[model samples]
Target: MDVNALPAGPASPGHVLEVLRRGGPMTRQELQARVGLSRATMVERLDALGRLKLLRTVGHQASSGGRRAELLAADEVGRCAVVADIGVSHVTVAVADLTATVHATRRLSTRQDPDVVLQQVLSLGRELLAETGRANDFCAVAVGVPGQVDPTSGANTAPPTMPGWSGTWVHDTLAAQLDVPVLVENDANALAFGEHLADGAPSTTLLGVKVATGIGSGVVFGRRPYRGVTGSAGEIGHVKLASHQERCSCGRTGCLAAAASGRALIRRLRSSGARTLLDVVRQVEQGRPEAVALVTEAGHLLGGVLATVVSIINPQQVRLGGPIGALPEFVAAARAAVLDAAHPVALRGLREIAPARLGDSAALVGLAGLTADAVFAPAAVNALL
Candidate 1:
């Protein structure tokens, strides 16, 4: 159910918490099977978790020719987290429970100053907590920003779209302001994790591509993001293109994002009154000849880059996400492009191309999950006991 590296018993409270958090409602017998804990030991584990308000008993499961078993789930009603998804021009904030369910959401423009933006996040979080009557029950604050980050430190190593953001102490500032565990992640990685953990998700290993103001991506394998050595594993936006010659925000020419990203589209379509990424999507959906032609080219460029990625990683699917990622035409175009460019061997058994379903709030949902996992790891849970 969850990533369990700990011994499966009361001795490892993290294992028990993580299992319940990811596996959802299940009888003690079913949970015991997954964690390999004896029934007697399971009682002790559950009791400890219960005291910490980390697990709970829901309604009873239907009896199968025997006594009905009480369904137990990770308790989320007692705690909450504040999460934010930061994009080029806006931020989506939410309050989520231990189970990563959003309770309230708000959207705000991205402030030019990081401090102001983070302050806004804190203010919004406080407001949400008060409204939800969990003002003091929120455990952490997390955000997904679009840039290369030092995952552990949560500081940007470089800023492509955001000028003067490289020096901001994103994690430390949030941690200090909120006085709780603060997590910062690449927006694409957060989206990938959200997609990976989605209910009824068809693939665990996949690529999450963001094609909004900029193009970025993340690789998730077995529910863990592959962030390379310095947390820049999936910067497909900056990969050079033989066919593209435009300049990128990163000061590079011939990058995929320089040619195919939404910002690029806006530049190319300014004469046609395209303003934001939404405008670009609207144009494509309206079947504007110019927009369709441009997006198709961008889609092919994206797919061409993804083909190389697929060859190396062999992902089950390439999940297109972000604002433009919601478009069906772009999804189809990318799918066809991948099929046309990728080797047959790599394409074997690859699932059909599909638009990401998590929508615009994908990063927020993921940050909440990450918040739960990190703040309640085995060691943290055991410490609580």
Candidate 2:
């Protein structure tokens, strides 16, 4: 095996690393077969990667006749991401590996101010990184906010739920602190990506809706999230209902969130001692008359928006999350409404109206994944090499 034998261009060291990263540990012969590289080329790449301490022999495989070949892996010795999932009520910070394997995590309540929330993320992220022994690993910083973001700059846009967040340079702020690449994503979009990963990374389109304090949705087209041109692809909560003229937080009338979101529901049940979305969900589970009525109506309204979503995009899977969306009763109502209102052709490709597989941790998982991908991508690897 010789380094000079490896051709230029696509046969870069990054290519060999990517193969091992995606396909897992394999013998040099197996890797050569997979990359269709000459033994000399393969050995050169392996030697290069080995010198960089990015490739290593993990174990040995069974042999046919000669000595067994050593199974080699992309030695991701200390790589990890510091990630945050910033929700309306709380923020979850964690240190995770490229596989989204969380090593340490913490959750804390926070105020509405973007500065306060981001500060919380910064403190907790550093704390977890140190706790998990990933403090020195300079990977990416990914934060998922419950709001819209600029696709290119990763700045917060005009998010109704997060006032004063619009135009905020989330990327700059975090990048200044952590000194690494930063990714700011809508919380629902992060959840969507997390759910996509949780479902074995299916090569099918998925729509993920979160019905929390403020309703929102995320779209995943097979591999990655669909941010759309304006970075508001799945604005399900803001869908205007033709029947209702209720004022939405976005200062728009007839938006579905105005009529059906947990915020709206809590406002209606304010005098009833409903302080949180969980309070409303408890009532629904208890079968309280008002709670059941309001949630059922909300479910129908949510479904109506989803029906339009289904008709337009026709995703293979629809994952409902958050406190209200995950409720079996609410899901049933929404499912029935989608079935009734959606076009037959649209429904043909649909699977089930399922609850999110990752639940509360979805956003964190997604953020970590997004961070790891950017940091460990083939291009990134090539640049490093």
| lDDT at 106, model 1 | 95
lDDT of 1 by residue, 97-212 (tens): 86677899999988568679878988998999999888878898888888788755556754566765564477777777666787788889888877766734634687888888
lDDT score, residue 171, model 2?
73
Whole-model lDDT for model 1 versus the true structure?
0.80
- Which candidate tops TM-score? 2
Candidate 2's TM-score reads 0.91
- Candidate 2: misplaced stretches above 4 Å? 1-9, 51-53, 56-58, 75-77
lDDT of 2 by residue, 1-385 (tens): 4544444466688887888888879988888999888897777788777876777678899767888889998866557887887777777888887677778888887566777777878888888877777787747788887777768766677456666666656777777876677788898998888888887755878899998888989999867899987687887778788999999998999999999999999998888889898899888888888988888889899998899899998888899988888888778889999999999999999977888888777777877777766775777666665
Query: Which pairs of residues have clashing backbones in candidate 2?
Result: none
Ten-residue stretch with the least lDDT total in model 1? 1-10
